[model samples]
Target: MGKVTGFLEFERLEEGYEPVEQRLKSYKEFVIGLTPAEAKIQGARCMDCGTPFCNNGCPVNNIIPDFNDLVYKQDWQNAITVLHSTNNFPEFTGRICPAPCEAACVINVNGDAVGIKSIEHAIIDKAWAEGWVQPQPAAVKTGKKVAIVGGGPAGLAAAQQLARAGHDVTVFEKNDKVGGLLRYGIPDFKMDKSHIDRRMAQLAAEGVVFRTNVVVGEWPQGSKVTNWAKEQVSAESLKAEFDAIVLTGGSEQSRDLPVPGRDLAGIHFAMELLPQQNRVNHGGQVENAISATGKHVIVIGGGDTGSDCVGTSNRHGALSVTQFEVMPQPPVEENRPLTWPYWPMKLRTSSSHEEGCVREFAISTKEFIGENGKVTGLKTVRVEFKDGKLVEVPGSEQDYKADLVLLAMGFVNPVASVLESFGVSKDARGNAKATTEAEGGYKTNVAKVFTAGDMRRGQSLVVWAIREGRQAARAVDEFLMGATSLPR
Candidate 1:
């Protein structure tokens, strides 16, 4: 609950961004968080709804109302406490989460909702500045060892919880560092990697062991997932060494568009383009890294990955950037009454889109056109939906110039070979087969083995990964001790 009339008195204030010209020069974060006073004002806008859908809307079930009330009272210390109660990483969610909680806010029915994400961003930033964040090592050791494969949000969250529950935890990652996708896939301009480095320090202080550059299972050839492993550990070895094993290695198999001229030079998966830039930003060398400079870049796919490509291309001093989507363009605004308190399909323009982009919907890439061995253009076709299926329209074929093409079509599943090595069953969608029931959540068919995050669910949000990680940790605890006090 907040001030009774606060929602009516104040308009929603969004976090500011640095000027485009200045931001394009570097990979640092550009978001300007709200001041303490400003955050308090936004928090006061939380209406006292009997049923708080904002909690249900959030994957982590963050105590949104309590935190808002705390911020309104200028109790920044307790605000972080309430925030960290359900969610482990408010900094990550506050910066990158889409804020479905705001969509579910009661005031959003007919007016702008409280700036929940901005308030959260401000609270966490202030908490870190005030030296409030500290490691919480368990009081007693359980002597149960857990091997967590993958160091993304899911594995990190699970490792922290298991360690807090007094279990010895070791996180295995193939990359040279922790933070999985957060370490590589996401652009630094959106969120600096320093956030992850600080969290890793906290985890280490809490008695969690991190083993980077170590692969848990086999990595298939030509995969897009980053691998810097100098050593490999087998599933059998982990099962023999640890009391329990959790697979949080995300779904990394990038989806491909196989069509004519698919093998042309200057065409690549978005992963190949994104992770290299991230490495270069961190002082690593990318020998033959793909560059968008002075090139006509065409990004395929209209999801967040495509948007990332657009922003990256612009940052690389690209000549022009264009994005294509197979689906019809959504309306600029959604019909709230028809789809309130849930994620609705509507046009969403990310900050990357604001930098500059030409977006085309209801379009399909017919074929990649090439000159010599490199991509020169793309043959495209406009299409319409008929009986809920895509159908090409006659006389809509068009050719567009493209010097470089980046496919951001999203991921299909986790690499199957890795799952096969563990003998873990897979769902129809190719994700590891596991239930979320408290009785048997995250348990794979193999004994002493569990799965969570994108490895179990398909490619999903980082918030969802954190939620699964926390829940899986509880499940592992319950299995180990026959009862668990950790939050689900």
Candidate 2:
């Protein structure tokens, strides 16, 4: 601990944000990070709590206390060194993670938790500025070949570890770039693509080959999985060529709302709308790109994707934006005694929601009203839970005006074709079946094949994906050489 009484003297300081009016005009990150002095103060807030729950709370198991102590002592270089030891990409998580580690902070039991995410953001940004973030190429070549499918956070993390372990690693991506969901699913306003770009440069320098615009399996025809791949590489080719294969392909099956007007022109899955916006930002064009400009828009599903839709709609200058959540709104404040030291359920208003949005909770859409093959409005009803069953209110049925509707109700599983092509059996939830045990972790039913991230565990946080990727990399390395030097 840097300061004995720092927690008593200091309150949590969050990172600053650009004004709504100024930031809404463009698709750029508007967060103002903390200065070095401010970060030192935040780091000092970390008490000498005997048990560091924040480390276990973090998906990547970051050494939070060490980094806090380093930052407090003004040892900026060592701060990043400790950070990178467990987490491969602090910059990505620092910017976008919801900070479950903060929830698990021991200080949070009685006061505001230490600003760990903000401190991490500061540390990584500083490391980059000082040119401390550099390529760590392997000292010797192991002469083994590895193929990583999908280039999202998980895939990238696995690739970096395998490459640094002296394996010939090649990442196969279906998009025009390496970042899977990070590059396309997330809007640029949340995190600019430059972060992924610089990391790609570092990975390439570390001898990780990236094969972009290459699909490892057949993309279902007329699917809305948001692929920009130009070429298809057979699964057989990868199996025969690579010494080991890791499936980091993300959950791409967008759950659909099979209502009456699902065939309407203006109704679409969130993936279709989100990726197009990212493509546009990258100086690419989408044929008949879905636009929310000047139209009454409705976003279904109250998750992160739905909030993103609200933000994008606001940026697009929509007439009105409304979001629907089938579940009732959670308490604004959680019952800390019941849920402390773990992620708590509470009302979460994203920066996008703060921008502007009408949020409807405990509501469900019944039907989509349309005219001339295009959506015009929605029929809805208030809902309540009785005996754990959802029941619609008898008199609450109504219609609301809407021209564009985006379904953001999360993904169900990875594209089945990719898993089937590898002959990998699926779990009950359709995710690739691979245990997380150290002895046979990430190994699929098929020999020489492994799975990680969303492909194995279903859709989850980016931090969890990164953790799985790193663990899977070690699993593959050990399987190849009978022992792995890479960190667990």
Candidate 3:
């Protein structure tokens, strides 16, 4: 709204990345953010639509047009204030969120949408550089104590909100550090760990106590959530110690491909490979670390996790790399007229895909062929969609060499032991059975125990997790005090 016709005058200016060759040399962030002038031009492109569907498009409901105008006017401090009003962590979302807001832009109906993500990136970076971001500790104590299991985004968000509301909040993580998946599952190249470190400092200053290396469940905990906690604690002990307990653990169980030779030595989950590299990157000791060098790696699953594996493998100097998808390939571009405000189905070639990968769609893994208990190859078949079901074609069989097979087919549910410890009910999908409805929302069958995020809603985006945490905190506050002022 700054220039009135700014949308017509300026075209979209995408963020740039370092060359692939240069980036692969080390594990560092590569995206170069926009300058102040370039960011202002992009912010001016906001049309300030009457409806502002971008608000609905964004999971956190960030005030888009308001911040856009602030940025366009060079009011960077105010711009970041507006941006942080809704989103707890603009820096995290600015770097990795898929930017559904851009898809919901009104101008996108005809031409390009405003670069909302880049503008957000600019605002936050400028805010940090100017020391505008600071802690907001509560002035008085409510004297009520709350315990949060898991130190991921969801748990952290809930902790921050409750702490700011004057509640004594403590976060229990089983790992050597906090940040959940953000600390380990995510590579430093995509987003450095320093962002998490800064947020940890802010949360600490806000009076959130963090207890690491304290597992809440039994063995068989392997995901990032499990790694956050070191030793197990019983549910009875947590219930007796805290006024309220919120379970926000992630779905750490990786889905497996149980085919022939499934127990071979060279096959592993993406979680196992990704976390080792992260520990190494953090200067932690990781004996027998997984590597892709001098190997023909085949990653099963075509989602973001697989793409991450692809990037890591390329960096490891893998001899060859290929990615497999069970579904048919989507069109390069979506029919925008039909899919405009909603996320559309289209071929998404990620930065890792660009690094180097032989992407194959409509392929299904049949079996893992191995020699002397080590993976040597895999049998696959072509697949087609028929009557809303995947039908495998009998004669379209093939085989490929694979020195290492990575299963990145997504997670199933949280580890069962944690839920069992609390006797929490689970939905058909194996996630916690806590409705988001107004009455008893986030409240489990257990009296004082609550659930949110991936633990309650199954696997989802980080933004959605933050939303769940905030909402759950509100619910917990109301349950404890019979009234509350926390935002939903």
Candidate 4:
């Protein structure tokens, strides 16, 4: 511990944000990262807890205390070194991850947790500014080829690791760019795309090949999953050409609300609207793009996706924006005594929610009311829990005006066709069937095929995806060379 009693002396300092009024005008990152002094102070707050649960709490098992100590000691280079040892992209997680590590911090049991995410953000940004982040090309070439399907976090992580392990790595991305969700799914205001671009350059320099606009498997026609792929490579060809294949595609199949009038126009999945906006932001033209301008927008789903819809709608100058959640609202604060060292269910307000949104909890849409094949409003019923099941409250039916309806209820599973093309078996949840066991982990029933991230574990956090990708890379390396030096 750099400062034994620093936790008792310092209060938590949150990262700042640009004014909502100014930020709503553009799609750019608005977060103000911590200065070096502030980050050092934050690092000093790390208590001398015997066991660092934050390490386990983090999906990638980052050595939190070491980084914190390094930061506290003003060893900026070593701080980033410790951060990169566990996380391939601390910038990505620092921006978007919910920081379950902070929730599990010992200081959080009674006081505010150490600002670990902010410190990480400072470290990475500083590292990049100081040119500490550079290519780490392998010392020796293994002369083995590996194909990573999907250029999202997991696939990118795997590609970087496998490339650094001296294997020829090629990442196939269906979109026109490498970052899958990071490029299209998340709004630029939340995380700028430049971060992804810089990392891609580093990966390329490290001997990883990125094949953009290339789909390695079938993409379902008429699917809302964003695809700008100009070339399609068969799974059989990849198996024949590459020594091993890792499927890290995201769970693109969005969960749908199959109520009445689902066929109405102007009602779309969050993916349909979000990806289009991102493309537009990237200076790409989209035909008949969904917009919220001057419309009453209703976003169904109370998760991060729904919050993003709220922010985007506000940016589009919508007449009004409302969000709906079927589940009851959680408590504003969790009971730390009971929920310490674990993620707790509590009311989470995202920056998007802070911008502007009318959040309605415990409400379920009964039917979509429309006029001339266009959504006009929706019928809803307030719900309550009864006998361990959700039941609509009697006489609680209501109607709300809505011109644009976005379903942001989250994704269900990966596109089934891609897995089918690879002859990979699927679990009950429709995710690729793969284990995380120490032996033969991430290996599918199919020969020389591995799965990880959302494709194998279902839709999850970016940190989780990175963890799975790193482990899957180790698994593939072991399978190919009968042993691996890469960390699990």
Q: Give the alpha-carbon lDDT of every model.
A: 0.93, 0.94, 0.90, 0.94
CA RMSD, predictions in order: 1.0, 1.0, 1.6, 1.0
Better of 1 and 3 by lDDT: 1
TM-score of each: 0.99, 0.99, 0.97, 0.99
Cα shift from native, residue 412, model 1 (Å): 0.5
| Alpha-carbon shift of residue 443 in model 2 (angstroms) | 0.4
Cα lDDT of model 4 by residue, 37-154, tens digit: 9999999999899999999899999999999999999999999999999899999999999999999999999889999899989999999999999999999999999999999999
Clashes of each: 0, 0, 10, 0
Instruction: Tell me the spans in candidate 1 whose CA falls farther than 4 Å from its real position.
Output: 221-227
Candidate 4: the clashing residue pairs are none
Looking at model 4, residue 272 earns an lDDT score of 88
